[model samples]
Target: MTTATTASDDVRLSAREAAERHLRALVGRDDAVLREDQWAAIEALAVDRRRALVVQRTGWGKSAVYFVATKLLREGGAGPTVIVSPLLALMRNQIAAAERAGIRAVTINSTNIDQWQPIHDQIHAGEVDVLLVSPERLNNPGFRDEVLPRLAATCGLLVVDEAHCISDWGHDFRPDYRRLRTLLAELPTGIPVLATTATANQRVTDDVAEQLGVHADGTSDAAVLVQRGTLDRESLRLGVVQLKTPEQRLAWLADHLAEQPGSGIVYCLTVAATQEVAGYLRDRGLEVAAYSGQTEADERHALEQALVEGRVKALVATSALGMGFDATLGFVINLGAPSSPVAYYQQVGRAGRGTDDATVVLLPQAEDRDIWAYFASLGFPREEQVRETLAALAESDRPLSTATLETRVELGRNRLESMLKVLDVDGAVQRVQGGWVSTGRPWTYDAERYARVAEAREREQQAMLGYLRTTECRMRYLREQLDDVGPDGRAADCGRCDNCGGVTLSSAVSDASVAEAGQRLSRPGVVLEPRRMWPTALGNLGLDLKGKIAAGAGPGRTVARLTDLGHGQALRQLFREDTPDGPVPPGLAQAVMDVMKDWSSQWSSRPDAIVVVESATRPTLVNDLAEGLSRVMQVPVVGTWAIRDPSVPPRAGASNSAQRVAAVRRRGGLDADVPPGATVLLVDDQVATGWTLTVAAVAIREAGAGAVLPLALATQG
Candidate 1:
């Protein structure tokens, strides 16, 4: 790509020359040559008024784009540059860089609330050139009521960093992002707005535009410069291992650590998991640290320092480690499957920062299959959920606590929170003093009008899920999802995915070849319930199962009984209701009650089990039930289902059975064929949904599985 050249190429030095001059003047180095692509991006910024989104991989000098823009704005006598950044660390880094370049930049955040008054005065006094503030800081009343208004009067330019936060589809959502639209509204018109992110899909692009009040029609005078660069790191080798046991996974990690020594990340799903794994790794003689949301700010800072200073070889962390830190981490091991591809991409993107070859190993626990299945089944939040959440926020008076907001909206808390935060970053809602409040009016378009747009967003999410479930061309899948067209006119087939190994496995089915190759696997049991049978079951059982589960419940103590389990008899007698046919199984209703109580106990004890469902049915139903249960129970449902093949000799409804099993496997991650000695269970909405049960039984038998039990809501058969 040729470097971008200004219209006045003769008078205006090329972007490269400008960059070199600035670098030489600032760092006393003239050898710094701007990359052709970086120069193109910088040059485009000079004249382009359309909001531009610069997407460059890490270490690609993304900051230089802004640096060049800053210089241009300053030279042109544009108003003082105001940067909205997500992280205090990033703000500090930028401020330091600017200071080193002899530019007067000031950062406002929590730590320097006292210094902010002077800084604010200086900004209005025209002493400060660049002002860096966190999204949260912008939401402050003082800033909003006093400082921001003053700054707006003398506006230079506004830049939003990590701008993907504006997309509800982005992995990391910040509530402050929603206020940007209001902030922009207050700014003088014609001031350039530049949004930068290393990762953003079309969904992100639309969200950014929407947040900035840019229309989808592309008629806005504001320039929309999108530079989609190659995120491919040929030096990075991606490997995924499916492990049945935690021990085996840890062993593999240890072996990998020993083989390749350098800075690395062992990413876990939870804070406790990070601590446990970090401790274990440390015990195994590996120098390690832990990072998670629960880690104290001081402690996290120390840990980061340790990593940067080479005092630690590895850090076991939750997703919290990926965003702000700028270390050249060598490897990243996913101890569990990330909730989404965006997460996986962000986590893995942290590695190979220095351009040298690195590795990203995904050690997906067998249990992770269910997590992936749950994600696949639900796909992404329905457009209704996103719309509803945004609508609720738009209607609210002040920022409401998540609990308070949940009572008003019909969505799972976590899912809702994630969505709200995304909208928040997108400038739909602002985080107020104690809670989240609407930044502006609700979307005014009729639901029917945006239905297609919503569907497109859903398709994009599904595409990402498909990439996760894919066994072929992981890189190709990623490139396709990003809509990246490489030079070859074909999707770049990253040589690292399982498919490129000459191994072809259907994502719809587990990679049996790999599974059978002695890679330990964890195959969840199938439950005898409609994949989405939670609502009906909850209603029929006359129990708020979600409530109990959230209170705390243990898996071992929770038992669901059918009509054959005897409790059904008592339930029918107590309620004087007719039994649904067949033999009223002994202890069924009582077993279900016990399961409900136990589930509650488990939830209280371990939040991870807070969202447990008694049955897993069809994909759509499963998604509905899970969403309902998550909202009602205030916990995310770990969906369970049974799997069976429809193509057996004695098969009745063979095709339906095969389709159900396929669907369940595609969504819930359980298979009929479990390894020998594996403890398995059959879960279903009703025993009449026996196709999945039969398949599960046959496959378990074939695999020499041990102790397969049936867990069902009803048995009409």
Candidate 2:
């Protein structure tokens, strides 16, 4: 194939026929034929060998185009196609789909580490027709320096699935996806490239198309073919159910989940919520399972299989189950709304892929905004943090691991790592074997660009809220958010949606169901796991602490996590920044008493004394909690800690292990006199880092306490 290849008499007819054959084989239906748009994309990639961007709705045969193109290219004696997929779930589904077409596809991802070398060998030996890799793999040191160069030179076609992630303007922007620009630029001339996404607004579409045409040498390439299609999904019936409380929402789900058409997903905003919701639903006799990023790889696979086979009613999940999770889900219920419409569209798109009339419902609660804000806060850190990180790497003679870097900087591990990835893509840093090292290249923080992105995020959030309140066609509003107008470029209604069809989900949930939900949520206690080992590389921070912690506080219990469904909702109100610090509330105190009552049954020994940790914030709450526990347990409030350096307050969740430990140590010592070998109950209003409680427990133990049993009103874990 040459760069000038395009629609021609001989090439057009031959490519179209081959694409149809591949399409039919993949779909397992003799009647399967390429849509006009699908054929256009395949013609561009296979017949013309030109870069193309296909922006279509979910279930619009985007994958068919790429797979058929890969087949046609390989049949023409081209090299194996290389696809950069965003999620392992997507890669897994793609691999299976390619098999249906008799394409010898192989994948390299974070999972299946032991098979990497063999997979690479298969590609080299021409035994593989397609290679699917996560975008993160593209920038990996070994893969980037070795494997990528070879793949770029020899790959017949380059495909980017979920391509919207490459644009910062995209709802689910991923820093790693930006690395595709390098891959695109390095590919030999005349190699065809295809970028596909089901959820990109016009802004994201244009941004991706521009990037697709850019070469590595900061120059533009030939025009890229852009295939845009309608975003409406006929199978989806969109509706929003406004609920007042978490209990009400849970009650609605419990009452109506079984009424939905088929097995589907119940999307929650947090991992903790998924567990809580799934457990509640299971108790109500629903065959549901909780899934999140924390779920083990093997278990996630099993859960996914169960969902696919209709063995479970639904999976209460976070966005971990989003993006390319293929199932003919009959319905999708959101326990909470996504922060933006684009993300919301992508998620709900998972439903109704292979079935008609899939129910898409959104249950929006007041706390959804609060959840959105919490996630929004995790965006790009302040300029000072970037400077500190760069300085740390620049000053080091050798590569410093993230743990060591954490000692010098205060950002949390996840945030730190995310920043490093962005910096690496920007040429300010490079990931070496040890960890990360600063490149000598000059870099500047693009405050203006970041500000614009933030503003866009805010607008999207507001639009999501508007969607909930709009009386117009729900599908139309969502499509408009994605800049998807019909062929006429005019707004049109999807006649099947709840709004357009005048269909409403019954808002009435039985009071008994609500009460039961409240009861389940109200019964709160979460295991407070004790730290078994000191954080890695604590010595770098001048702390003597290292390795296993010596006989530290035993496992304890907390009333609830600040993110839990039941008492957690109430705790959030109590801990809001604007909320005045005061004595513990009646409900929280009752929950704490309940937890203590249940915990004492399993304790090896009963506590004889209670100790409260000093809290610069919520001191009154801590003292009150300690006093109440002391009164209930018939123990004395024997001791409390003092703040030695009030000027330097504890930075709760901002610090890493070393910084947290050091901060806690800087606080004044406990002043209690404990009888030798006496058990002590450690009390605190909340356990954020858990370091504060740990440091206090150590002090109590040194003061003659035999064992420390930590208890808190809530945990932030």
Instruction: List CA RMSD, all candidates.
Output: 14.5, 1.6
Q: TM-score, each model?
A: 0.61, 0.98
| Global local distance difference test of model 2 | 0.88
Put down candidate 2 lDDT per residue, 1-717, tens digits, no spaces.
Answer: 126475668779988988888899999999988878888888888888889999998889888888999999999999999999887888889999999999999999999889999998899899999999998897788998899999999999999999999999998888888778888888788899999999999999999999998876787765689988988898999998888888899999999999999899999999999999998999999999999999998899999999999999999999999988898899999988899999999999999988977999999977788888888888888999899999999999999999998888888887888889889988999988878999989999999998999999999999999999998899999988998876676678888777887456888899999999999989979999998777777777677888887767899999999888788888999999999999998988888878877888998989988887878888888888887777776899887867778866667334588778877777567878777898998887788888877878877888888999998888888
TM-score of 1: 0.61
Per-residue lDDT tens digits for candidate 1, residues 390-462, read 6666776666766555544545455566556555545566555677878774543245634654465456556
What is the lDDT of every predicted structure here?
A: 0.57, 0.88
